[model samples]
Target: MSGRLSATVVQQCVVSLGDVRTRIDVSIKRRFLADQDRVYPGLECPVPNDDTVELLSSVIDLYGLTREVLLLEIPSYPRLEGATVPDSGGSNSGQDQDQTDGHPFAVLSEFRERMAK
Candidate 1:
């Protein structure tokens, strides 16, 4: 039997910082077993004395290759076109500011005084 498979994939483009859409197409051919050692013509049985003996099976898995292709085609880095990033000042810029709002650990000075035993 022979058949075709197709899919639409949405992926991120790292270079363009945008979404990439593509169509993937695959063709498959399948065969059935007729005999023990004659399932496939090109298949060869393993021989101990033969240096170039190759073992062949009657099944062919195409999903593994399809997944590998999808993974390889994915972008390494992807970002939005007009995304904005907030400015985080240099190391000591927010050091003197109180970040917590009325929390118990906000009073570090009192904690230090109590721990001065």
Candidate 2:
């Protein structure tokens, strides 16, 4: 069995000033199997809902898996280059230092000094 699913969703634009609309298209193919323990390369196994190990009692449904995969793949936070959040009247701005080339361990200097006590 083969089927396609399409949807339109509003997602934060990664390069624009406003929310951007996106369309997602997915196609699924059904495969019949007898043994559930058989490993298939390049294919994802069915995700279980709980601790129950339900064997071949369940058939592999690609459409349901595709929706779950799409949800998992969506970014939680999307921001454009150089995008900065508006200050809410706070004393300190939440800007991070430019440490692209610098070492991440540089911040450990303060901890090392405190530990010396």
lDDT of 2 by residue, 2-90 (tens): 56667777787565556755667876444444443465655666655542232353556555666775785466666655667665553
Clash pairs, model 2 backbone: none
Listed per candidate, the RMSD to the true structure in angstroms reads 11.4, 9.5
Worst 10 residues of 2 by lDDT: 91-100
Which regions of candidate 1 fall more than 4 Å away from where they truly are? Answer: 1-56, 92-117
Q: Candidate 1's residue-wise lDDT over 34-97, tens digit each?
A: 4435655666753355422224456545675456555655445545556555445733235434
lDDT against true structure, model 2: 0.57
By summed lDDT, the worst window of 10 consecutive residues in model 1 runs over 46-55
Residue 8 lDDT, candidate 2, scale 0-100: 75
Q: Assess candidate 2 and give its TM-score to the true structure.
A: 0.41
TM-score for each of the candidates: 0.32, 0.41
